[model samples]
Target chain A: MTALLQVEQLEVVYQRAITAVQGISLVVQPNQIVALLGTNGAGKSTTLRAISGFLGLDDARVTEGAVRFKGERIETLSPQDITRRGIVLVPERDKVFPNLTVAENLIANAPRGMTLAERRRLHELVHQYFPKLAELKGREAGYLSGGERQMLAIAGAIVCGPALLLVDELSLGLAPVAVEELTRRLVEIRRELGIAILLVEQSAAVALEIADHGYVLENGRVVLDGDGPRLKSHPDIQEFYLGGSGERRSYRTVKQYRRSRRWYG
Target chain B: MQLYVNIAVLASIYALIACGYVLIYRVSRVLNLAHGELMMLGSYLLLTTASLFTGHPYLAFAAAALLALVVGALVYLFLLRRMTGEMVLAAVLTTVALGILLRGVMVLIWSASQQYPREALGWANPAIALPGGARISTFALLLILSTAAVYLSLFVFLRFSRWGIRMRAAGQNPLLAAQRGISLHGVYALAWGLSTFTGGLAGMLLAMDSGLDGTMVVIGLKAFPAALVGGLDSLVGALLGSLIIAAAEIFLIHHVDPLLSDVVPFLVLIAMLVIRPWGLLGTKEELDRV
Candidate 1:
């Protein structure tokens, strides 16, 4: 089977000068949860935006790369056009329409060929995933807690019936318990909807918790990639990202070790 | 009682026109100063269509209304579309320039004369006697009814319809709205079209009530303070603001000075700005963001 989304040698430059993302390549297979883990400024968000057609908003463009969705190039399309083609991004912040109520937020998304009955069924389905949202349907999204806001954001994207969902920083401002719950829900959503997800996050633990395959990005380049369990157990990932302890090593030693390590991809 | 009648009539007029300002401001965050000129153009269109369909006033009104809708959408599609990514101040200035251009073009086309649209449409403005012994023109009564209808329908449309929710979504977070597959330009164009259609309704009714002239634009300008006092983005605020300004203007005209009629709304607007700059119902965050 073909991949749902493929980003090849994607280099994004902002405002004609600063290169935000440099030669990043990734793919999201159908029904797969692909984790993109990186620290801030590692170009994780930039790569997601590039795939979701939001690069133009920040005066950024794919200077040397291609984003293919269902075997069609989409990096040059408008955000709306890209979204209509089933690549939806749940952005890091301002994820929910603040003034709109939870129900309105769900309804506000552009319906992706869903009949009224089907849309209603999907609404009920979303409510099933997040019962707290159903309880606060009339409350404005601005007043929702961070977790609830995240739920609404995901629900909004789900309503679009996207083939590939790009979620940026899902655990950014949520409590650990909230993050765990949301990550569990993400797994359920992927299984039920059978859609691919490219999950971009700073928290390796939260992302790799359910990701089928994972890639580690450093300075806008993929430094390592493997199956979820393999990446989780990798010495470098365990020490740096998962924060697993190593034999009382000094920071300088770890830095030297990091510099010496090289990928054979 | 007469003062109340006058205030209600004036309030109705301001509310109808102010909604146009609110609609455009809410969706695009751009103050359309050209709305007054567009309103006047709607009245002039009525005149042209009326003369064209000499024996059919309803057809003329419908044709003129349709033209107004098209003109408003075209303004966004052609002129204001270029100003989309610019600073808010620059966009406002573009509208100011557009208003002047429209004014000059209108004068060159229709001439700067007081033309009676009622006469052009073969209709007469008759004074209706109220139960409380207040005399209001028939068209003033229609204005009140039309204002009620417009506000009711707009409230329903914005609160319930999917497109209306989309418009609100677009206004609140344009980038996110675009990310969700909403065409921002389509939403903006729809807002402009609706704003002008309602403004044109106000202009047509007022022109039918009184003879059309250059001063109609001033009346449009005066109504903008109502929009500001109510909040630039809230339709409910617009209605309440119009009532407040209308009451102040009528009371000042009768009790203080006749000349205060023109200045009272602005004075109230300034007072509102000082006390509550975001207007009564407006979200406080909107001012800071804008």
Candidate 2:
């Protein structure tokens, strides 16, 4: 089957001097949950932004390579146009329009054209996934707690009827219980809606638990890629990402640790 | 009673013009310094339309109003669209330049001399005396009525309509709005169109009440302080600010010095800035950005 979304040898440059993402490529099949795992500044967010058509806002651009969605070139489209093509991004920060009431926030999203009944059904679906949102519909989003805001953000994206969802840093600054609940909801959403998700996450344990497939990014390159079970068992992942080793090391070994990992492409 | 009537009339005028400022700023966070010129342009369009549709006064008025809306949208599409991702200061400066250019072009086309549009439209300004011996011109009453109609509709639209909610969404977080498939350009253009539509209405009414002249732009500028005093982003603030400024101007002119009429709004603005920079109904957090 054809991939739902494809990023081929993508190179992103910021302000014409800084190379944030260098020649990295990935794919997402329809209805699949794919996690992009990385540490800080690993070009994970940049890759997602490139696919979501948000690089222009940061004075960054996909200088080389292509982003294709359903066999159409979409690297240069505006964010709204990209969204209309059914790729909705839940960004890392400023995820919701803070001043808008929760109900108004849901109403503000422009879903693909649907009948009145379908719109109502979609609304019901969102409220079903996040029942608390229904109760807080009258409250302004700025007043919502971190977990509630994340739920609202996800709910808003779901309202757009996206075929491919891009979530950046879903578990950041959230309680572990909240993260577990959100991940469960994400799985349920994917199963029910049959939409592909490209989730960028820092926590390997959280992401690997839900992701069907995963890619490990380092220094703007995809250093590793495998199915969920294989990646979860990989030694490097266990030692570095999952805190498998309990023994302490000196500062010199700590500084030279990254060179020791056997990264495979 | 006459002083109260004067205050009401002046307050209505300021409120009508001030909402234009509030609408654009609230959406795009750009201060349209050229709003005065745009308002003047609306009056000038009425003058042109008046002559074109002579003997059809109502048709002329409607056509001019429609033209003002189109002109406002066109301004966004052609000029401001280019400045979207740039600094807010740059966009504001562009408006300043646009204002200067519009002023020069208006003078070149219509000349600097005062022209009466009411005569051109074959309409007469008749004053109706109130019970308390206070007289208000027919256009002044129309201005007050229209201001009420505009504010009422705006509140309803922003509060309940789908597009209105999108506008509020776009204003608060443009990036999130875009991600949800809301076109920023469409929202911004709509804002410009609505702002110019109301501003043009104020200008046309003022022109009809008194007479069209170069001085009409001064009225537009004077309304800016009223908008600032209420808060730049709130519709309620605009109305309240206009009333406060108008009351102070009228009362000070009546009690202190007549010449204080021109400086009253500014004085009130400076004091408001010092005391409560966000204005009465404005969001307090907006103080840092503005």
Candidate 3:
């Protein structure tokens, strides 16, 4: 498969003597879903942000690196330039444009090249992936629930017709069932749209299960990199985190959530 | 008929100046507190150009507008760029200083004279009737035409152009718009350019309606009431606000005591501030930003 986007020794620095990310590099090939897994502050999110160019005010700088998309250096480019060039980012925390309606939000980021018919067809593609979004078309994004908001964020990125999509922390605060559903849809989208994805997640088990390849980051460095199944079975990963499989625990937690919901009612 | 024409002529010029405040303040989210002084500066520039004409009024107006564009660009680059991301206080104060500067320069250049237009006094005498029993003269028709042309072209330009979309985006979220490759400097320059362009035109027209003097700067001050009452964010709101003020001034000149004449704009201003601070047509989201 052709390399859609590639990075080399990317470094992102924050203002206050803190290096948010130091020399991390990854690739997103067409139809590839590469997962970067670590606990909070492992710089996974920072790495993703540097790629998206959401570097906030002050001396936040991409001190050194080359992020090439379609063989052009894009590390120093603006976020909207990156977006316009077809590398879309769905920011963590399910951040959809709050004031805009779901449809307006989608249309705002939508790629502008087609006849009305093709535009509707692309709209149908998003609806197919997150059918629930179709019903909430006219509703303001601020009013969406956690799951629906995530769906909208995903839909917004896809609308850009990006060659590579960066998704940061897809499961942060999401329900277990919702995470599973979102993961399934993500793989489906990678297949259908033929867009490479670089997904950063805090959870190892869920991340490894859906990922074709995984990079295990510890502190500011990559500790392990391998095929998803091999990394999932690695002893070091189990020793530091994951703690054997989390399936049984997630299932119990799902049941507990239902019971709590019932009791609150 | 001539007397009837004079009111309409003056009213349209008032509306044109009022609308400039509406456009920049509404879209750029700056009060443009110096707008009145800028108009005064523009009029003086017009007068200087018109003095060269001796009898050619049209040439004077055109030259004033052209030169005003260069002045607008200079203000945007030198004054406004420094204050771009500054707080409302800084932006407001900068414009206040700009007003003082413009006034200082006007005195330096023109020596504070009360000057009459080169055209003959008989120019105000011609008149034409409207279907509703209102009548207009040549001066009145020209004023109405210019006013209509300014607003209409601005309305269509902003509504239809790609640059207008960028301006809207910049107004909404400057950072995001910048990220989208819109040059913030360019947008500010365009805003100031439009502001000064219309400002010069309005000043030239008003000077034609009456004689030019140093205190003619107050006409721009009066425009604030119009912009404020109409809602700074809505283009049409300025026109509505100005019409109300003009009507109040016209009817009050003889009907109400002259002592209370200046109080009318203030009264309407206070009422809107208390009742509907957003004005007649300002979008609701602007309230939160304020």
Chain A (alone) TM-scores for all candidate structures? 0.96, 0.96, 0.86
Q: Which stretches of candidate 3 lie over 4 Å from their true place?
A: A1-19, A29-33, A36-45, A62-164, A167-196, A200-265, B1-15, B48-63, B66-70, B116-137, B248-252, B259-261, B288-290
**Between candidates 2 and 3, the TM-score winner:** 2
In angstroms, give how far residue B71 of model 1 lies from its true place.
1.3
Residue B112, candidate 2: how far off, in angstroms? 1.9
Which pairs in model 3 have colliding backbones? B128-B136
Model 1 docking tier (incorrect/acceptable/medium/high): high
Q: DockQ for the candidate 3 complex?
A: 0.16
lDDT of each: 0.91, 0.93, 0.74
**Superposed model 1: Cα runs more than 4 Å off:** A246-248, A261-265
TM-score per model over all chains: 0.97, 0.97, 0.72
Task: Rank by DockQ, highest first.
Answer: 2, 1, 3
- All candidates: interface RMSD: 1.0, 0.8, 4.7
**Model 2: per-residue Cα lDDT at residue B159:** 95
lDDT of 2 by residue, A63-129 (tens): 9999999989999999999999999999999999998999999999987676778778889999999
Candidate 2: stretches off by over 4 Å: A250-257, A260-262, B288-290
Worst 10 residues of 2 chain B by lDDT: B281-290
